[model samples]
Target: MTNPLGIVGAGIGGLTLACALEQQNIPFTLYEQAESFEALGYGIQVSPNVVRVLAALGLTEKLEAIAHRCYGFELRSFTSDQTLIKWQLPKNQLYYQCRRADLHQLLFDGLRDKSKLNFATRLTGYSQTTDKVALKFEHAPKVEVAGLVGADGVGSPTRRQLMLDSQQTKPSYAGYAAFRAILPWRSPYEELAGRATVWLGKNHHVVAYPNGNLNHGEQWLNLVLVVKESQWQEEGWTIEVDKSQVAAEFQNQSRLLNQILKDMIASPEPCYKWGLFTRPALPFWSQNKVTLLGDAAHPMVPFQAQGAAMSIEDAYVLAQCLQRHQTTEGAFQQYENLRYQRATRMQITSRKNADIFHASGLKAIARDFVFKIVDAIAPNLMNLKSAWIYDYDVTKL
Candidate 1:
């Protein structure tokens, strides 16, 4: 009998890959360090590109039930109460804004081989041979895998080991911090309740959209503030912070923006923040039988909101290659060849967006001028600009 494939994380990318493998009757085991799943993370956006993959994996009905479909966004200036760009998202393609924990549960429950999943199994290290890779967990005995996949996310031990052994660049801090808040979407903020909005400022930017809890019958709003702060260096990590402190960070913004930021956590619970980080797209994501996926391979800043979307795409494309190619070696190569360019482009463009979103002085003027021209000449240019990303259908690939 063949050894089962090893998946070293239960994140969005990891579980998605596992489900796809199970759908095809491919043997695989998932290792998760967390004792149990929790809705701990912040908001997550699912673009049309990833929705197509999820639908292909038989998650269409489930997503339709819980995912909040967002049609467009109104980009506003932080200093002035003026519209910068009114982008009407493409109609044919669907986009969903959701709680990360909610989406994680949906993916987790959809997996077929729960019997093969191991929780609280921290991946300590691994060793690879000619035909198999051996994984060492903190508690469990060493397990051999026919092929190894590292979906462990940024600061991945698997990636660190691979780069250390092969002499490659490690993941580095992206010089920004992300403050996130989730709270009830109630009365008084009617204008901000149901739509996605972006507030662009110098050296910082903010995004807010509607998200809800289907189980609890609650309406909520999700806010994320990305700012340049190099003084505190916390690499690839998130920590609990005071809600009042979070409000103060954005206190100088417009009245509406300030009110929304303050109300994001009106409850007693605290808010949280994390340092954003990334690594240059590796020249090769796969070496021998071991490979990297998702944030483990290409962690990007959140400017384009495609971090999870790209990871979902990676899983779908890799699964297709694995089923199509007879050998794991050829499948890995084909997967990288097909996916590397797209992932690299996403990483680079995400960085570019950080600069574009936080432009100041002459740069800001030039940006707004271009936006005005585009908004006037081509109102749907934003949709057309992202057609390559949204139109991607991995099932068709």
Candidate 2:
């Protein structure tokens, strides 16, 4: 009998890839290090591009049940809280704001065969031969795989071993930190429901949107505060922090900002802060029978809000390539070729947005002025600008 394909890391990318592979009737096993899936308490944007892929996987109704469909996006000023640009999102294509854990759960439950999922299985290393790859584990016996996919996220062991030359390089800090929290949806912020909002400030910005718990029938708001920070150098998204650490950074700010921050702090939910970091692009993502996917291949700053979306797209494309090609090397090569340019573009653009969103002094004034003019002349152009990204359909690829 033919050996099954093996996938490492059961993140959004890994789970989505498993679903896609199942649709193609490809045999595979998914390995996850965590003993069980934990609920992540952050909001994730699911743009139309990724919604296309999820819908293809028979998750449309399930997604609608858990996610809030965003009708538009508004950008406001930090000091005045005045709207700089407001545009309705594309009606034909659906955009959603949902809790990361809810979406993760939906994807996990979407799989046709739960038996293929192996939790508490940590991959230590892997060795590849011409015909198959052997995956090493810390506790269990090694498993031979016909083809190996490293969906392991940032600081991936697979990437480290694959790129012997680049092993010495570390992830460069993006000179910023992000604080994420969730609060109950209330009257003062009732206008924020069914829409996404951003308050752009000097060297900082805030994003807030409506998300809810479907199981409990409760309404909630998700908040993310990003600010310039060069002193602290910690990484990872789950680092608990006192709200004072965030409040201290925004002294003498507008009342609107203060109220939101206060709401975030008063919430019973835990608050998390993590430094933003980006890694240098890999020269190649594939080597022989093995290749990387999602943050494993390219970890980017979150300014563009496309980090998860790109992973979802990558999952579908990689699975299609694997099914289309006969040899594992050919499949890996084609997957990298198809995804490298698009993923790199997202990484670079996300980095540039950090500066754009945090523009201050004359740059900030000029940026707001341009937004006003564009908002007056042609608001649709603002939405059209992202057409390339939202209009993409990976299932068709």
Candidate 3:
């Protein structure tokens, strides 16, 4: 009997890759470090590019049933209360605004009958021979996989064992921190039920959008606040934070905005906070039979909301490369080549957005002015600027 493929981390990237492999009738096992599937109290934007991949994977109907289709994104200046830019999202393609949990559940349900998923199994180490790879789990029996795909995320242990110096470009605090929470859709903000809004300031930004459906009683809004900060030692996504401190971070903003932050803080649920981190592009994404995917390969800031989208793209393309190539090593090389430039470009662009959104003095004025003019004359063109990103169809390749 042929050995099944082994994947670490049951994230969107991992699960999506697993589904793709399953579609091709390739056997695989997914190991998640977590004890069980649970909501992580965070929200992520599913851009059209990612939506297309999901559609190809036969998940569009399920996703569309639960997600709110965000029409356009608007950037508003906090000081002047004026709209800086209003770019319409791509048409025909659907962009979902659902919680990470809802999306995860969708993928999990899709794989419910696969009989190959293993949870609470943490990967401790791995060894790769010329033809196969063996993985060691902390509390589970060792399993040998035909190939190891490390979708284990930014702090990937598999990547640590395989790479020469995986810790060299360690995730550093990008001089900023983010606070995210989900609120039940109430009135007043209900006007924002369908659209995504970005309130931009000198060194801070607030983004809010609805998720789930109003009729299904699953309607909720996801809000994220990014603020410039001096220090951040914690690196994981599940870091705990003080509510008042989060509210204080945006004390200088408008009262209405502060009220939103205050409501989020007062909620019974715990708020997760973390210093946004990014790693320098690795020279290569693979070594022999082991390769990296998602945050393990390219961790980027959330400036462009492409973090998860890129990972979804990686899973699709990596699967494609593997299907096309004869050997694991060849597929890894091609996957790196096809994905490296685009991911790196996005990483650089997301960083630039951080700087541009936080600029002060003359730079800030120029930035705002450009956004206004672009919104007025060429709104569609402004939206199409991201066509290179949104229009990417991995299946064709």
The candidate scoring highest on lDDT is 2
- Ranking, lDDT, top scorer first: 2, 1, 3
> What digit string (tens of lDDT, one per residue) describes model 1 on residues 1-397?
1898898989999989998998888788999898976645668888888888988999987886776778787888877857878877766888887788878888989986688788889999999888889999998889999888899998788888878744456766788888888777666556764458888888878898877543445567788888888755554377888777777767654777788766764765467788888877787789888888999999999999999888888988888888888777788889999999999999999999999988999999898888878878887888778888888888887
List candidate 3 segments past 4 Å from native. Answer: 112-114, 234-236, 252-256
Question: Which regions in candidate 1 have their CA more than 4 angstroms from the true location?
Answer: 165-168, 213-216, 234-236
Q: How close is candidate 1 to the true structure, as a TM-score?
A: 0.95
**Residue 175 Cα positional deviation in candidate 2, in Å, after optimal superposition:** 1.2
lDDT string, candidate 2, 176-254, tens digits: 8888888887778877877889989998898989885433466678888899988564545458999877867764346
lDDT score for residue 384 of model 2: 71
Ranked by TM-score from best down, the candidates are 2, 1, 3
Clashing pairs in 1: none
Instruction: Name the candidate, 1 or 3, with the larger TM-score value.
Output: 1
TM-score: model 2 vs. ground truth: 0.95
- TM-score for each candidate, following the candidate numbering: 0.95, 0.95, 0.94
lDDT of all the models against the reference? 0.82, 0.85, 0.81
RMSD of each: 1.9, 1.9, 1.9
User: Model 1, 221: alpha-carbon shift in Å?
Assistant: 0.2
